[model samples]
Target: MKDSLLWDLSDIATNETFPQLIADTKKRIDKIVTWRKHLSPQMEKKQFVKMLNEIEDLKSVIACIYDYPALKELTDRTDIKAREMKATALDIVIAAEESVRFIDHWLQGKDVVGPEKLNDEQAEVLFSIVPEHKHLLWRSRELALHTLSDVEERIILQKDLQLSEPLLDLRRIIESEQQYKIKLDGEKKTKVIRTQAELSKLTTDANPKNRESAYRVLFKEYEKNLDKYFIIYQAIAKDWSSVANLRGYNEPISMRNRANDLPDELIDLLYSVCSENLGIFHNFFELKANLLKIPKLRRFDLYAPLKDSDKTKYSFAEALDLVIDTFEGFDKDFADKAKRVVAEGHIDSHPSPKKAPGAFCATIHPKITPYVFLNFTGKTRDVFTLAHELGHAVHSLYSSVNPYSGQNPTLPLAETASTFAELLLFDRMMQLVDTETQQKLLMERLADSYATIMRQINFSMFEKEAFALFAKGTNPEDVSSRYYQNLLAHFGDSVDVDQIFSYEWAYIPHFVNSPFYVYAYAFGELLALSLFAMYKDSGEVAVNKLKKILTFGRTAYPIEMLQELDISLQDRDFWMHGFSVINNWQKNVQNIFSHERI
Candidate 1:
């Protein structure tokens, strides 16, 4: 039977079918090309505005048209039609971008400058007409050194689609479609699981043996296919490094840093602070081990539930109510925006065969109420994931006032609302539990923090080294050895790191799909934690501050926007504030244990 919580996709289709949409997209691209041919650097302000508007319209149309097929593929990877349609949609987007490439190249030329930086002659030109596009123009000028000619850029995009993209698709297919088998306690027969999401839940199973079995099953599968995984990853890394080199980026991660509009110093500081604070998590692991009444923790036991942990299985409906009510407690608008996702049938709320692992909220355009994908399994973490994805939906809705170009925040700030929502949910969950369960909840929150903040940083650090090694033509075994060393460094002596855990990196999709994307989690969590502290102290004022930050979207530099709220990203102290919160929680767990012993 289809679950009641299953999302309704009837609203996804429009009057035009996929074929018609593709045809319309082609016509749109051709129109843009014709429009571009008629453009001139010496054009009037009105003409410039018209050209910008046309490009913006094309972008919006592409986003709206591509969302359905892309979403369908995530829901069911086996749907060959969806896959084809998505590729077609992507190709059309690339074609449209290729056609309009000259606009940016022209803007980056001497004829155009930022509003503040414009000369008398430049002021007379069309670029000074739109103040809103000043940042876009200024940014182009700043990156003019790396901005290739339209032809070169086109070649790179085409090569990425033809070469790098297929490798990514192959990795996804292999990782997502593989089946995992494990025998549970008291079961003579083995069980087969289709999706990694199903298998992952067992990693936190209350039973220690079940957790061990789950890890063994997961790593064994990856170990068997290590060579293929290595080839795919190595190729992707090489491609990424080559492109970075071609673009004159100092390092592979510098490309991502530039795209995120953050400085290399800032990222280096973030990573340095995180690496220095490794002992915090090491202490946390020891605390967790003591709580579990074990001598030491295995990597598999990192998320293991405590003996007295709340094992209450929440229904989907129940989880939805908890999340909604939690949001409502903070602000009615936030709650309503989150509820809109559910009301519009935008949430796919259950796990199924071939469904993608993990949860995400897809914002197609400002007008669309983002669709959320989930593999809910009634665990407490599942409830938090519900809140997390809904939080992303609310953030998108809040930023709807922005043009398509400015609607999405850069990767680091993107997690602010989502992580803050988890904080709200965590606080509410605390209120509903007894003191003992509250301690358990605190422990779980710590585990989540370790996963969200430290683990992601670890991934980012590994990527930095892995990318460098691959560029030097490092072997797969050496790469795996490097990854294992990273694991050992991350866990230290507080937890046991096994050989099979080296295969764990292959299981991470972000490394394949978007390199260096994991660090954003750490950045967002730390930022959100600091903001949440302000909320606890100032209440409605802090809420309004967050709402304002969400609305800023990509309108200003993230650092400037944050500075407007008295949040500074310039120093190590700001990052330390977040770790301090985690440290206090660890101390509280110790206090709870101390009190019990007396």
Candidate 2:
């Protein structure tokens, strides 16, 4: 159930004080960056340690202000004290960067502090900000924004290096049509699909005829203009590879794992399991075809309407009520926060052309911790998306309370609470509905779970093989062809291979926006589902343990975090529990189909 109490930001009383706070904070931080350049690019190791301390001190102050309730929300005093506090902290960050710049300046050969017998506190400065974001917000920038300027240094040190240039360019490609051309066949078409968000309306169309055509028109444009987009991808790949080479990582992907601090064994274990279990998805597809009484299940049919047209269509308000009511059943604390967010206007439920595709929660800095920019289109699917994104907001809200903290958990860990909440709500929703609706709901879950499991794992295999082929000096055509061939092998005979093949990868936003990121969905979903099984068996005790992990901040690493729920990353049987849950649903779907044939 979704919490009805979520509010839109426009309704929040941020008033004059909040705006000033944001303004002053930006200015203060900007100056700090400027001052740091006094030190040469290469400071002695000793001087670098001194600069790190100054940063830790600034983070402590920022954390204090963030912990303050008025700064977290709106000021009751209207005194603009929040503004001053924000600005001062921003100034400190600027100073921290200046210290880095000073180190940078000294690297070119200049005098600086020595490591002569520094105390334990001085040694711990960098670690102090590890789980907290106060310094990372800048350190990552210092490494990336200065990329071309300090190429050798960047490649060597920054496995954790964040690059906004590629992402910024991607955003431009999505929003700006004139910047990127769209072509069809051997000819360039005047009718270009402007952005990825535009494709969402196209891709999710109800009619299969419409969906097939929409995808064709949309992908034809991408396929023909491959050189342009491929060039952008090439640059990103080349840069990442170069940086990885510099960092002494075996590959760009290895560098990513290093930066994320993710265990290679865990990743390998996930792939090994998923690869062996692909038949699960194949069975799911066959079951869907049976229940729908169709001869074969095509890719477009995957997201088709689960129930007939006469079934209930949820209004946004009704959906909100259901979501709110569902979550309240879990506990009152969850219910109260949800109610306030809705009532106070913390959500932007409407979707627009200018807004980005997909939904995410940005803490927007701990001092002014607010969730921004949601795009909803009133589908029952949208209801789940709302629950999912709100879960992100809830997780972020908890993490933001401390200020100067990392936004939330590590990537895989971040999805745990959000997906778990959805399962909790979905399960209860199933219990309340009639038997027919229950069947439909179970079908939806089976479809969704298969996608989370096989679709993503198949994608991971595609990336690995594609990149491996590329490493052997393969051309774009070879890579594309190879990908299409493997996709057919994965999707099998159930889908319209000719129409949806090559262009399918074109629409995957994750491939363009976040590389090697698809696996996390399967990883998180199965992990959460397995944990949900425990809850069903143990009830409230299980729920309490999971909640503790969510609120633990990033103090715990990924493995340690899972321990809170007593879920094991090491045990194959743990994942098998969730797989069996889907398998059980498949049996039900199969039985329905068997009867329908009569």
Candidate 3:
């Protein structure tokens, strides 16, 4: 595929045929409803298997019907018909879920109080009939503990349908519509960049003035619409808090912890380990300043390229080949799987004025090769993003042995392959460059480490405080002030953070899209660091172990699946070891800078 090329949509239904696809999905849903009506704990194993098959079939169809329009809407935000179709698809899925709510209620023994109903133990006994799906069924029982009564569940679903959709859509619409103008380093004329991805390129522009101007341009729009964005965010927070409270979670983040099937204590440990390691990043910033020959580093200079850094740019095809080659160095099977996404024409490889800003991999179903969406600008980082997203696709492909119910991973484990992909590419690039270029690569790696680990942890910290403040009837301005304080604590004396940076919180889509989702990036990056260390030491053996974990998919909890690698979720030293790997890299960069003057 060429740069800025749209993916082939023929594999998915066209607008002319999409309505029929939804109609067919509804018919399957009706069939599943009939099957659910007859479901019982005491049913024969053969009958139970048949019901499972029907449910999986319905889910497969629903995935396609829903994803078709959703993918279209992401690529072209101005596609009104795509938006409406996505809404219709969502409503149908919600109704289908409501119609089959009896399954969970019956499994939890909530549908009836008498002896005929099944409790957790009895449900597990029935679930044992399908050995491959036992964990999925058990997970359902765990979630049912937090499930509300049938009436309350329906009300919440209806409320979400009415309130959540438009709020999220508003954010997407505003972001896609915003534009920025910046003067090139050597040119007097200004360039108009319409997408966030394009604007992000200027933040790392070689000229310091252009770098600062990019930040100003980026935050200015957010500051202008501060009130509107805050209102939307505040409502989203309250809505999430209300639902989490009704479900009996102790705190806002606790709900996310439970959804990931992780213990709250584990997340707490991650926070503690990262907070204690703040000095590592602090020293790295000083090292960065030394290499740049600057007295101090500013927040806007976090991602600034080294003064003599290599400025080589890759074409779309070159980037793809590099990623595939990097994966092939680990395992040819991995390289082939990454190529399948492209061969199937499942990647949208460029930016557009109306396209979504960031990158993501959407796995519609286990049988389908995942579709990747990117705003490729041909920078080296964009090459890593290509590897990152294709890593997600490889993860999905590896887990194809599972049924639909077991195909999706929890948030914490979801970043494993993607982060590992970037590291593999980093390793490959490091081997091909000279000493100075190696130093530059190390700097880029450290910058990414800071972004993925410290930055994300700080975002989660702000979220924890923001949610508490929002619950106390605090306004947006107060929350903004608290966020600024949070940033101060994060940077400490290492970097200068400006007040305009406080508006940065509103610019992050995760806070509005997925609350508490930032921690997963930290979780994944640390976990990947540890995994990369293993791969470096043991080679193919470690590679096989990593594959085993991915193959498990949602078949087991993250902690359980990670046992294949002997990883412990509750061990403080385990998390600390990941930080140590980063510390070592920073030390190497420091050593390199000490030996030479830029």
Candidate 4:
């Protein structure tokens, strides 16, 4: 089936208009709050079950209400109506959070005086009435252990909704408003570049001058507003630290680790393993520098193509077909689900002015089809991105059998399918290309691995240090210098670490929007590498195991879910094994170059 180029949002609210949907959502919120306010420990099983059902319905309605505006805004950041709708939706949802907290507290039996555990029959009946509540119960109990009083929790929630969230939106608005006018070859007039998606295309331009100019213009524009970005980062960091301290977390990252159900030690181990194996990427960079015949690789040269080989742009249809075929080769079901994302009008596949720069799959609710937003430029990486986002959509579809609460996985496991999809696409490309093209493809694949794994890990390292510096009241300039040092550590002597690149951190939305979130990319990429190896060795059996894992969603802890596939996150050697895969690729590239020299 042919995929639609643009996503259809009408299906999300077919019967009602945006204002009507907002009003309906408010009614559901009222209903939920009323139920929660009347909740008591002495309530009967029937009453509890009724409340759970209402919560489930409320979740579905709220998800649609929030998601519609979110998707609309992302598709066109310039849309005033979309932005207003998003703010309205966020207001309603933030209010609903109070009710949610109450329910969770009650689920933890916090209000009960010497509450007794439910018998098996009673438990079974409760699960039967609201199967999703089974997952919610565990999460609620886990959160209850770390939760503060309702009053304190509300304060934090209010600060987040009123302060932190608005700051993030302001940063995005500022970024979207930036326009870099640069002269292009064969064009008499300077092209106005607004989105990062456009700037990205120029980063890989065949001309070194073009590449350098693009980098400078992009960074220069951001430099002009560096103070604002820094202030935003500072406020976010302080807010995060304040909340973390209040919650008794040792560090801001520790709070995130707890949220992901990941042990601090496991994350430490992963970071250490990746740090030790930085040499593999260093070697890749040295090789790239040699290929470019430069003394050292510049920041702009980082994404420079090894060869101008086959700049053939794939149309949206062709990209979709390629992605579907790659997934089909692995499993027809995977491909079918990916196709359904398009067929169901769930994918926005074109780039436009004021649209979000990157791609993402938003799984709003378990019952609702996931929506994917993409700024497709027809680059090969764009194809991989399409596959990646579609992989996320498929993952949501796989977990759709679960309740709304259980439909989304932890952040680390959330990236598993998306990165795995990229790997699958890489493998498919390797098979289709000629020997010379295979070498180029291999280099491209390794470049991606370095970007996704090492680059992200380096970003996390900067966050680790930046957080500490922020606590010490360090200025953004000092923090930028520290980030430069982090880049130096990653690149080592293989590449030139320009001073200007220090300002690059100011543009990273993750640091401000989601603190310490970059590490999940490294974690997911490494884990996906290990999982991809398992797929190659065990084939269909491993594929089936992966499908089962995706179906888990947030039902089980991430580590426990992986253990089902005989994968141990705590095993130090398991992470090193992912490095070994990269090392082998490095060796293959070395051998390819050696053969060419002869």
Candidate 5:
């Protein structure tokens, strides 16, 4: 809820001299390995401990740079700040990549560090991803960070967004807009601030007319310069796809699945099953439309708020209180540490210009702790977003102590704790709503599912098709037009998707950004729902098991982590059981409407 949390990178982060930091970390890591190699087979005690301490010191530096960007400078803003940040990022990346190569390409050849020091079960866990590539172990400038830099340099910053040979010179215009002295509305009175912040908040204004006007303004600007946003997105896809190919991946999906250690069967199964069940989502949406007393659902109606209820506006302070209270019911230790996150400057919870929209949690370093970011606007969804990201923070916290590198969960497992936390809050609130307001509450809950499960699944489907098209050298216009058409069909005839949503493609950072990341929302939400449903019968012991699962991190593959909960997701019935719950819940909704007559 706190809008701005101070970042303390100096303590754990690199000294900003990236080259020196990389050089120093390399020395420490090499020493640790050297000591390991020299230790006599009979004499492995205090010497090992000393080596671990040295490794921790180096990890602290690597994590601070990658995890907590908001603290050091180049956040989603200030090109100048990002310049130096990029250099530091490059150093961190190169360090990681080199480390991974040494362990996988080099150490494996040398025959060292297997499951003996670790339990056999623990040793089996090393089979995930690059086992040699632990958290800070395989920091590669080439993988994510450097790719981002190269793209930004050649695509985002250096090459203009517009596609023209006249050297359009739009950056200068944008920079001038930034400096234009003008007063924007809202929290900041008509006081002069930078134009970027002013332009952005205009879209999120409380006033519908203002929000609509802001949308018009945005597209008008973008429409005139469609070439830029389009070209950048195209280049990014091309670059990532090419990189994936060069790295010997069949496609981006392989790389993604590899990160999660998911088998081809599991992923293929998830895609098939989730796609097959859009009926449950459709039924849920139809119920929502009936509750809202509308003939049809609109694009805007998809996120429409409930009416005639006690809507208590929560300040940032109030929002934090609600979160701490809800999470405390689950685990006191969790609530305690969550408060520390607030006390320290871990959360950046405010809307600002040039800063990325949406919320995310950063796993800075296992040795330190994780941080959460949000653009809290005191809305109902904002509270849940906070809870969701907190789930990620707690998950990261448990994985920190696990010495094994795989403790960092895959993307599917990544969303489990966060979405589970949200369900806890949602179910508790749904139970408390008044009889007359239950319809509204049900609609609200259904809307959340619609976004997470329904919409995300649709996005995944679109990405699958679109990426395939792009890979064959389809032009940007063809990709964008096809994407717009697909978005319309997915939403169904209920929504007037023709207007107010076409430009949606340009704003979606995920599709242009991270390929195949959206389905994990649908995957984790259903998994969490299934697991939470089990808690009703299992009781307190189940709660402990849930916490233990979070601690599993990368140690257990997605399928194996479910095993800890005694639920195997691969079981056709286990997955269908998730669908059955949704059907039962939808029936409950029908009953709620039916009981209205009684």
Candidate 6:
């Protein structure tokens, strides 16, 4: 399995097909519900413990049933069966919301015996068996304050799921149906630029004309279906707002921040720091434009390569070796865990027309190894992506000792390993490349940094504006206009903003799927940059600190976890320090250019 690049779902369920698996899951869910019905808050301590075990088992089964179909649909968006199965499974899981609420309610009740009440010996025994379960218990109690009544919760769950289906379907429609015909190198080519992954590569095409054509075509498709996409966006935004309001959240983003166990103030600080440092990226864009021999960068040329016809490419096998070796250099355990992902056939790394664009690492349950999905195109960036997603896999593996609920870090911390992996890969490339190629790599790294950090920060800004406008019942055109203005601010005068690119916001799935989620990338990249700086300064000690943080999973709050390394999320200066690192890289690029001019 380690030798294979494709994911083998057999480990999840081999005897049954997907349909059979769904049926089996339903039966198991019913049994759990039936068992749950027999229990009450008045139950004995022994019975309470038994119920806790039952809930854990139920969570594991639910995760197992949900993940395979979801992964299937993501791997091939055109698979109707996979989509249907995933939708059905999600509906079942939503229907079982009562069970979850019921357990949480019971756990929160005064009649339930808690760990503090137990004798020290008894507490020790429980801790030995489920050391992390105490955190889950505590979390449940915290959520209990926010939990709606079972009936109300079910209605909201159903409504959210129902609203989500169309968005998912719309995503499939866009990915599978969108096409753009353009002329390149005196040849007319028809490209099905559906996925962001494909459009991302196309945006960096060596030819400026090709890059412009790709951006125009990409946005034009969204513009063509503007009304439909707008309605979808409106529905999703309204639904999210209504839910957040009902949950007593101050705003839509507040709900997301709470879910990630982060303070709204911390995110605010992040955005504020980034917004203040926009000049750094503006300088980068201007430098890039100068390097490209253009007076000003068009939005399309934002990702344009500094050099024409860059020959850097890596085969999938070669990419695997490069990422594995990079990880090994950083930490042997990191490399070994990354290799296990490929070895266990937990990666889907083929390029196909219908395959979903982008890459992700999905960890279904702590007991099951994580799976990675990639649209590997053999590009040098693809190698970094390979490392990024595999970094997520390794993070999951490290936290496998946790229960399913405790295994995953919050969204910001979740990117810690993935972004760290990219940094390691960048350093490795620097060490191995000639001076000319090294400069190219540095330019590419700068571009990536801007993309991941400032770009995401700008997206967060757009979301804030868009959501505010949505609350006012702003029209789609008005929303698009606002988005265009956001882009103008993001690029400043360093790049030319096209009208068509205003329609660009219409295609960003995160705005529809996960509102206010973009900031996590900004949060993560900066955090990783800081952590990498620590690694450079402190070496193995920093590495050990990171390993400890990853292993803690959700047991500790992310802010508290970082404090172990003397990093403070609330410190504006700390975030500003990350920008300083970027500024240093910008200086390095300028130095290289000046030396070349000589």
lDDT at 101 for candidate 1? 73
* Ten-residue region with minimum lDDT total, candidate 4: 112-121
Model 2 misplaced regions, further than 4 Å: 1-23, 26-208, 291-293, 306-311, 315-317, 351-358, 365-369, 376-378, 400-403, 493-496
lDDT of 1 by residue, 1-598 (tens): 2334666655655435767767877887887777655555466667778878878878877886678877787878898887777777777877887777766666666332222233335634554677666666677777877777666787897898799989988988888767899999878999998877789899989999999999999989988888889899988888888888898999989999989989888999999989998898898888878878889998878888777667879888888888899999999999999988888888898888888777998887777778899999998889999999999999999988887787889999999899999999998987888888888788888888888889999999999988888877787688889999999988889999888888887888898889998898899999898888778878999999899999877777888888998878886787887888788888887788778841
**Model 2 residue 141 lDDT score:** 35
- Candidate 6 ranges with C-alpha deviation above 4 Å: 1-4, 15-27, 34-45, 69-92, 108-131, 167-202, 315-317, 352-357
TM-score for candidate 3: 0.90
lDDT of each: 0.83, 0.60, 0.85, 0.82, 0.62, 0.78
Q: After superposition, how far is residue 327 of candidate 3 from its true place, in Å?
A: 2.0
Candidate 4 collision pairs: none
* Cand. 5 TM to true fold: 0.72
Q: Rank the candidates by lDDT, best first.
A: 3, 1, 4, 6, 5, 2
- Model 5 per-residue lDDT tens digits across residues 359-384: 78877666656777788888777887
Number of the top lDDT candidate: 3
lDDT by residue (tens digit), candidate 6, 322-411 = 889999999999899998887788888976777677789988888888999988888888888999999999999999888777899988
Put down candidate 4 lDDT per residue, 321-393, tens digits, no spaces. Answer: 8889999999999889888888788888887877777789989887778989888888887988999999999
Top-TM-score structure, candidate number: 3
The digit string of per-residue lDDT tens for model 2 on 353-406 reads 443355665554444444534556667677777777767666666665543345
Q: List runs of model 4 lying over 4 Å from the truth.
A: 1-4, 15-20, 73-84, 111-132, 166-202, 213-229, 352-357
Cα-based TM-score, every candidate: 0.88, 0.74, 0.90, 0.88, 0.72, 0.87
TM-score for predicted model 2 compared with the true structure: 0.74
Q: Count clashing residue pairs in model 3.
A: 0
Q: Give the Cα error of residue 272 in candidate 1, in Å.
A: 1.8
Query: What does the lDDT read for residue 581 in candidate 3?
Result: 78
Give me the runs in candidate 1 sitting further than 4 Å from their true place. 1-12, 15-21, 72-84, 110-125, 169-202, 206-210, 220-228, 315-318, 342-345, 350-357, 375-378
The candidate, 1 or 6, that scores higher on lDDT is 1
Residue 59 alpha-carbon offset, candidate 3, angstroms: 0.6
